[model samples]
Target: MEEKLTDRMCPNCNDYLFYMEYNTEIPYEGNITIKTYLCKSCYYKDVSIKRHDMEKPKILKLKIRNKNDLKTIIYRSPDASIKIPEIDAEISPGIASRGYITTVEGLITGIKEKLSLMDSHDAIYIEERINNILKKNSEEITLIIDDSSGKSKINSGRAEVIEK
Candidate 1:
């Protein structure tokens, strides 16, 4: 019997998939059967057969690069346990090779982290601090002003640091 499955994009060819029905003469009990489709390039059935070995995105090695000069670094793994944030895009679960971390906010977080600490000379202390920050789940760190502005400085607003 053929059953209609919800529309899903074919992971192999990145094409749209839809269910279809046909009249049968052998006498069927069910209403529908799930079918594979791709118009002229049907690869859904084959991909399903070997779906077990599909590679999952490794959060550790995933890197984000830009399309501009490519020399400016967006983000790099500062620690070993980086978590990949789930995005709504349907493009492969792969990290951005060219435009992932292209936003100003993302750039800020990336560059701040990259410039935060020294490599070997300050790894231990910075790691501890980072661990503490992560454990606290603090969204933003606020800095309070101790001394008032001399003449024309704004002293009321707080500068919050958001860790990525």
Candidate 2:
């Protein structure tokens, strides 16, 4: 139920968007979990988990056609300026290749992994893969998993984790 963003066109580059499917489960008291494409373009996997903290599951289902698209997802989090908590979103491109642990980019990477977000889309295009990992900051997982709480953090374009 988000805005049916099934179709999105990156203003910078016109690469068709394809959401890498994701299935997530958050824990009631433990860490959040996510299951997404390990190699989405090449290998797709079915993931599942049950946690008490995460009242329900949320799937981000993301796709990156080019560098511009990738950058948007990663930076958009902090730019929103809202502290995200206990999340279970999925993203493609499982690594961060952008910055170090002292810069804004670094915080983005840290937040992503903490949020339990996976950008592991099996990239079919070698060029895209290289760009995503090497040029687009694959080391960082922009999505985050805040402390487990009985609440939902998924919106049309954002997630809001809360306590019950």
Candidate 3:
């Protein structure tokens, strides 16, 4: 892993901000670069990731059933689209989107955090459904990821991969 820390101006506060960059290799995957910005004045922060190697576009799918499945790791590229149809939840790549690696449970927790921030009836309903899924009250849920960069993956034996 390579790390660098620098100082820059924060876009939101016009104050001195801390910037960090990391370059590292993931086993079985290519090199990845991550950049982070943090503003001490406004408490603003941002992070982004990019892969050094190019790959063919592909789609991956995984089913979450038992507690063990929640431990499955996921690598989401900056150009990937993540979808959980059962919960009507989807995350599409955008200009501000960042890439990250996390477990299935971590992904669900992230979605829950976003849902809790919304103040709508639909959001409440979805949150409840997601809660049930997390608690194993519901049936199996499928996670589908479409990655244009082809750097994303569901690291599990049950994961299905399709090239596009």
* Winning candidate number (lDDT): 3
Instruction: Give the Cα lDDT of each candidate.
Output: 0.30, 0.33, 0.85
Candidate 3 deviant stretches above 4 angstroms: 1-29, 32-50
**Candidate order by decreasing lDDT:** 3, 2, 1
Ten consecutive residues with minimal summed lDDT in candidate 2? Answer: 77-86
Candidate number achieving the greatest TM-score relative to the actual structure: 3
Candidate 1: worst 10 consecutive residues by lDDT? 145-154
lDDT of 3 by residue, 1-164 (tens): 43344567778978876777888887535787777787877988877776689789999999899888988999998789999998888998998776788999899989999999999999999898888877874868899999988989788988999999
Summarize candidate 1's per-residue lDDT along 61-96 as a digit string, tens digits. 222222221223222211112232321111222232
How well is each residue in 44-161 modelled by candidate 2, as lDDT tens digits? 3333333334343322322333344344323221112223121222322223321111333333345444434434443223334333543655643333423222232222243333
Once fitted onto the true fold, the runs of candidate 2 whose alpha carbons sit more than 4 angstroms away are 1-53, 74-164
TM-score of each candidate? 0.18, 0.21, 0.72
Count of steric clashes across candidates, in order: 4, 33, 0
Using TM-score as the yardstick, the better of models 1 and 3 is 3
